[model samples]
Target: MHPSTLMMGYGYEPRLSEGALKPPIFLTSTYAFESAADGKRFFEGITGKRPGGSEGLVYGRFNGPNQEILEDRLAQWERAEEALSFSSGMSAIGTALMAHVQPGDVIVHSAPLYAATEKMIDAVFGKFGVKWVDFPAHASPAEIEETIERAKGLGRVSVIYLESPANPTNDLVDIEAVSALRDRMFADAEHRPVIMCDNTFLGPCFQAPTQNGADMSVYSLTKYVGGHSDLVAGAVVGTRDALAPILALRNTLGTITDPNTAWMLLRSLETVQLRMEKAESNARAVATFLKDHPKVERVSWLGFLDPSSSQGEIFKRHCSGAGSTFSVIVKGGEPEAFRLLDNLKTVKLAVSLGGTESLASHPAAMTHLSVPEARRAELGIGDNLVRVSIGVEHEDDLVADFEQALKAV
Candidate 1:
């Protein structure tokens, strides 16, 4: 079934819960077990002592109606066998990292990552003795292989994390190439590295990382999945084997979303396909408009990829759409970027993306601000680059808004 159609009643059976059309928020912390035998069985299954079977409710932490239903629906959309939800995107990311990484292991990540993700790797993971090596967005397939070889020389490579259509800059990475490299890296039984992709930018809609051989796919459900800016949540979807540990960690860490948030996500999922399609159309129109504007130095959008461009083929093969997020480099630096941001009336000057409303942000001083200046330069996320997230608004209105905003610069 189509995702939009599935969104209405996937994973949730109204007949299961007093014939409620919508799954009611299982708003309690504990559930009543039918008997001591039932409690023992539930705990046994949760702790892996016994296999889980189709049965009655378990402890809230172990599994709740909201969490289980959400996971079911999410798994269907991403085409994964299972899924787990977290309280926030970073929690989902960090938990997945923690599950696979250990002290003295190395993680090779793609460049132009979301700033917070960088902090988790550099600052947070550094304390635990996990090392990192970055592969730039424009790096060729050979360069990625070489980087892995170099990292292997230092020690073991445990994880390869990628954020394609990388935040701030709309550069695309070849997931198939990376997956092939991962197989080579793990050819020896001594070391096997997991390939994880942050698919938040163009997730279950435009791209499916697992389809291209990624071990797991992550998303900041706070963005496109939530649709509106009201909810903050995250999710990781993968095969049952890859996601079981993540679910266990999630339960122990207590980073699960509440029933209300899960309900909101369910509602949002219904409209995600429609919302993303319109947003992508709006973005294509806006990007075309920006390409012809004299003040815009360059537009980094996958939709604009030239046939000769190195990333063009990868984008064409993997991405269903160019996504709604793109960055434009103005003639001047921070001053010009801010001037354009400040002048926008319809598109708000904000940090988050993938919402119904358009938003513009400056990487140098906003999302990527925490990244060191030197490192930021190396990644090509410059001060002049202004990121815009097109919404379902009128394209002409958005174009006019950008035209007027460019005048301010």
Candidate 2:
């Protein structure tokens, strides 16, 4: 069944909820067990003393019916074996990193990470003696392999982190190529590194990382999955074996989303496909209009990518759409870019994307500001770049709004 159809009621039963036709938010911190033995059995299963088949609820932070249902339904989006939800995107990311990393391990990753994440790796992880090495997201597989080889001098490589259509730039990474390189490089190692892909920019609708050989697919549910900008959440999906440590760490850290937020996520899932379809169409039209404008220097929308190029081929294999977010470099520098942003009446000047309303952000000065000046320029995050996220608005209206805004330049 399609994700849209399954989202309605895949992991829930109406009769279990007093025939209400939808699961209620079980707003309780603790649950009643039938007997002492039942409580023991559940804990044993959770702690891995018993392999499987643990039934009944325990604690809200540990496990709840709403969160379970949300995880089950989300797994179907990427066809993953298991899924876990968290209070926020960074919580999910931090917990996943801790589960697989240790004091002496290294993280070899693609550059242009979300600003906060890069800062966390530099500040927090550095205190524990864990090191990180990075290369551009567009680096060839062989080039990335050389970087990994260089990282071995520092510590054992435990994680290969990536964010495709990376943050504000929308650069595509070859997930399959990286996975193959990891296999070739570390076949006889003590423990091979895990490929963790952040699917926030184009997930659930267009890209499936695990299907392309990544060990885990991570997401900021605040973006595409939540769709309405009403809630904040995150998730990770992978095979049950790959996720065992992550689940254990999540329970220890109490990072699971609340029952109420889980219920809201359930509501949003129903219309994700529909919302994404409309927004993608609007983005294609918007990019086309901007491409021909004399004042627009470049539109980094993937829909305009040359199909014969390496990046385009990888995008074709991994993503089904260009998605609604892309960056535009204006003819003039920062002054003209700021004018366009200031003149927009309908679209918002905002930091976050994938909301119901359109938004524009300056990558160099706003979103990716934490990155150093030289590094930002190297990553193609120029001062004139304005990252635009198209919404489900009428294409004509969106184009007209952009046209009027560009006139200020």
Q: Write the per-residue lDDT of candidate 2 for residues 1-409, one digit (tens) a residue.
A: 9878999999999997899778999999999999999999999987878886347788886889999999999999899999999999999999999999999789998888888788777778889898999988888888888898988888899999999988888888899999998998899999899999999989989999999989999999999889888899999998888788898888789999999999999999999989888999999999999999999999989888889898889888999988999999999889999999999988899988888889999988997888899988887788999999899988999999999999999
- Please give the clash total of every predicted structure, in order: 0, 0
Report the lDDT of model 1 for residue 57. 66
Choose the strongest candidate by lDDT. Answer: 2
Query: Candidate 1, TM-score vs. the true structure?
Result: 0.97
Model 1, global lDDT: 0.87
Residue pairs that clash (backbone atoms under 3 angstroms), model 2: none
Question: Model 1 residue 135 lDDT?
Answer: 85
